[model samples]
Target: MVRPGQIYKISANILKSRLQMTIRASISCNGVEIADVTQPVKEGVPEILNMRV
Candidate 1:
């Protein structure tokens, strides 16, 4: 779904393994590609913060 004032490309891929599995995702919004992000998989935490909020 496309929202007003928002642009993005969403995709997904899956990897199969014996002891481990991995899912890959790629997202690009408004010509800015978002890749290579590191985060804790168990929580919803913002990597960057805004001081105004």
Candidate 2:
């Protein structure tokens, strides 16, 4: 669960045994872009991509 007035970390995980790739994403609100992020994912590893309100 998420609550107000708190920061959170967004993450992505790769569960495959032999897969790797780069993730690109954008966060927007009201048609305005807030964050642009890129994260690399390796096999069986968790990537913390962004942390914001």
Best by TM-score: 2
Tell me how candidate 1 scores on lDDT. 0.34
lDDT of each: 0.34, 0.70
Worst 10 residues of 1 by lDDT: 44-53
lDDT of 1 by residue, 1-53 (tens): 43445444333322333433333344456787544332222123223311110
lDDT of 2 by residue, 1-53 (tens): 43445555678887875758887766667798665677888987888876354
Which stretches of candidate 2 lie above 4 Å from their native place? 1-8, 51-53
lDDT of 2 at 13: 80
Residue 46 local lDDT, model 2: 82
